[model samples]
Target chain A: MLRSGPSVILFLAWRGLRQYGLSSIVAAFSIALAGGLFLSTWKIKTETEKAFRVYDGGFDAVLGVRGSKVDLVLNSIFHVSNGPDKPLTQEQYENLKNNRAVKEAIPLSGGDNYKGFRMVGTIRKLFEDHEWRPGRKYELAAGELFADDRQEAVFGAFVARKLKIRVGDVIQPYHGLDFTGEDSVHPNDFVVTGVLEPTGTPADHVVWIPIEGALNMPGHAEGLGFAPSSVLIKFQPKAKREYLQLLYYYRNHPELMMPDILMTIAPLFEKFKAFEFALTAIAALVALTAAGVILATLRSAMNEKRREIAILRSLGARRATVTASILAHAGLITLLGIIGAFAIFAGIGSFAADYIREEVGVIIELFEYDPIFLQVSAGMLAIGLLSGLLPAIQAYRSDVAQNLTPTS
Target chain B: MAFLEIANLRKSFPSPEGGELPVVEVKEFTMQAGDQLALRGTSGSGKTTFLHLIAGILKPDAGAIHIDGECISEFHEARRDLMRANSIGYVFQSFNLLQGYTCLENLLLPMAFAGEANQERAEELLEQVGLDHRMGHYPRQLSIGQQQRVAVARALVNEPKLVLADEPTGNLDPSSAAQALELLRKLCVDTKAALLLVSHDQALVDSFDQNLDWRDLNAAFEQATGTS
Candidate 1:
């Protein structure tokens, strides 16, 4: 008995591709594109999910005068979307701040823009509550956050990327409720006093200035009695449920002048979670479609390889061996395509992260492993394997004897 | 006892045009070790089908097939594959040498398929086929004759007891054909393998130890059926 080597038909399997001509190349490409579609969609959805999870850690109610739900949600926290220019007054900010049951309240003011990006005005101490630290907080890759409400500003990561901003460069902000367009004029010249380390969030796209400086800006005029888009509050440990009830009572009191159009942000966050799940499902479908596309290509190629398949059987190759050969070949191509797609996704992640933060104030770090990624990838792979099975079996079940005959 | 025996073999297919079309039928055929027999026929006269059935690539509708005197007709696929691998060596007219592999790789193919990779034996077969210098050349790089020689080497590499070749030299030039046939015959005699050569070339068939005309075999099949 002559001892054989690895029973692998990898060599013959490879020949099967070459024997068929240009068909295999088409299959490889189709499989690759399908895998890439699954990969990129998964990456984007995963990034969005990750960014939302980060947002989840902070904030509760969005207390504002009036606006659309999506717009209010965006500006209340994001500040880039549309909202009232005249947010809550100092008295209103202080009113929430003084409420003993409130525990802690962070006030946000809207005023200026650095180029086409916003300069958010907020209380300084709240940065600490946001867990913004010396090592982690607005560390100036170049300078420091403005210490006073003067002509000074902290540049967002994206703005810095675009403007090539550096310490001591004066930046003039446009006067508008929305910074969608640039209208830089009127001594809005703010020295680039700081550059924040990338937070991979919308904050990375902002220009932070003192609330006093924002109020002094000409754009800050003609707007009054408007509560800030939102006030984030943290309850004391073991705080009672009555505290929220009393706060709501005060919010509606006629004398309080609180707007009836208050949107509690907790529900908004729950809505976001639901939205994330829907999107994840959508991502899974897209990935499966990619796999389905690959299977269809393989099925098409089966007809073209009939002669070669017949030849394999004539050589005493069992039906299963031929089937195994097809499966092994296509399976390998899919796996390789998956790896290639992953590399492609990794390469584009940073740019994508920047895009999210700038277009919407959501920071998305590249290396963060969102579980949705694995879920989507697994689903896609399962589809791919399932797709390969039928073709492989067909290859196995084919009549090898008839195939070998030249006349057939 | 003969190396291969076929008794009342019948096989057919469900033709697209209609009911079962009888492809090949043979009654009481036997070949001993060291005998070279040639089967001559037209394209559709069941020549390839005969080789296929003997090689266990196809199952007969009804027949008895024996390799080394043991009935293999009723054996399952796994058992038939083992018998085919151990006893039967086959060469196709196309040389079917996997284009991607080198000559040595082609020669080693059967051994690899049968899980009987004997590197030394494979090298020796390459040397015997006069392809020692071209072992590293791919089948595509070799001429048709050289490729056939490599195929022959592959067929005989596993040292099977019976060698079956379907038009072993059909695609080769005259001189190469002579060389390939002489090699097949010599290898059969030397290794004690029952060599069954199928071809349309009457001249080549006449030179074999015995000749089985497909016309006579078909007549025999019909007579046996008519008698039964």
Candidate 2:
């Protein structure tokens, strides 16, 4: 015999909830769907930001044709840029490489694909002299880097597995940017010479080759010397001490004005803030719908609950006890919903990990114990209790004398 | 001071005709501790209304209800609620047992409000009601007679001073009703709690130690036509 009115209320409320098992499950499931959506969206945002930060390669700036700075960084670094601007001339690349403030400049050019994988044309220094990530240089899993200007290709880990091309195998390049093109440039059989180790970055899906071969390709834009799609510059450590001076000089210099040197990483993140805000609004709407479902379920079930509540009153329950019981019922439903939502999140994270990695190069880390999850759960509990307010008030005002008599 | 006392008690509800519809009017009534009384009346003749007024479930329009020397009608709603929980036990016509709880759980329900009830004593009361064998059975699994017996056990769980039963055996067959009535009366006596039962059955009324007709106790009815 659990004494105290509140204990009795809890016991009775639990019994009542169990009596309508199907309705209880439906209420909990609605909340679970909302919670799961909210959690996954947050997870995606966290992982995407982490990926962007990690892949910045410690570079200070990007220089490209006067256009979207985001597109310049995307094209030069990740091979996902959709810019229509013409490639920069070799004279511009040399001019940037010779700048006193510049420590290194890596040239990039690409408009072709090999069997659904983007073909990147760059110098051997991109592999040997540059760090693909801070303190981490590019290493081959098998064979060597492309040393000859002949049409030899180096496959990323995913591309090699996708195309099943070994070191001695030959493949043809498609002329267009999109990978699904049917027009293969004949007599341009590129041989696979190397396969790089997985770096968990966008490079896992590209095919690397010497820039000279890409420049000599028949359909490529004719230039005075080697042309590049963009330039990735690593500034001298001294530039940080004179950041304002360098910023003004880069933004105003005439020779560097045809193409712009953009402090792009910071601005790109500003755009992501808008995307994050939209996702948060979507999560809020889902939670609102879930709250509505819980409220409607309780209100609809109040009819059956009237008799039960009256019986409790007749047994000497105070109005507060009755109200507490109703709130307790709602709290229990939402608590179960939160538990189910976590399970659903884990299940979906596991199921979508490979696909997300393949499409966007972000690993969906499952079961990463985070305090934000606890905060989300607490917020949902509050929502559940708030949803119960109307029904609890109704229970408190129940007519014990009338509802006691058996209804005809 | 009486174990239960009422003076000039009156209660009414609003009629559809936009006037007060008098439900109960009793000039005086009293019951001593451990006494058994039967209130017999037709349906809608204010029998249950009087019971509600005495139990503090409804407020009297103009009167005082004193139980154990304290006038309960003067208490606030929450105080009345607490008094009812601690001192009064009700057994309804339909047995009103919560559906999912077992016989033992139903017996322990009042204790949850009134505070610590001896579990051993609850089991003993269930045995006294001839339900020792059905302690684990749910309400729906028991016969009407068995359920009423469980209700009787539950009413005595808090060891209240007064037990109000309204047509407790109304839905039982005659034999089951007799058995249920016997168990209810026995438990009330054993627990030393006064029992007040309302019923329309003359035969049932005849079994009690004292019986009063509703028309005899209703002052408003007597005055309306001057015929009591």
Highest lDDT: give the candidate number: 2
- Expressed as tens digits, the lDDT of each residue in B51-160 for candidate 2 is 88888888899999999999999998888877887898888899899877889988787787777556787788888888898998899999888888888888888888
lDDT for B117 (candidate 2): 50
Clashes of each: 17, 0
> Clash pairs of candidate 2?
none
Compared with the true structure, all predictions reach lDDT values of 0.67, 0.79
- Give the alpha carbon lDDT tens digit for every residue of A55-122 in model 2: 66546677767666677777666667574377778787887788777787887778888866688888
lDDT (0-100) at residue A290 of candidate 2?
76
What is candidate 1's lDDT per residue for A219-320, written digit by digit as tens? 556555334545656555455675666557655664432222224333445555665566556645655655665577667767766666766455455566
User: How does residue B103 of candidate 2 score in lDDT?
Assistant: 92
**DockQ class, candidate 2:** acceptable
* Native-interface RMSD of candidate 2: 2.4
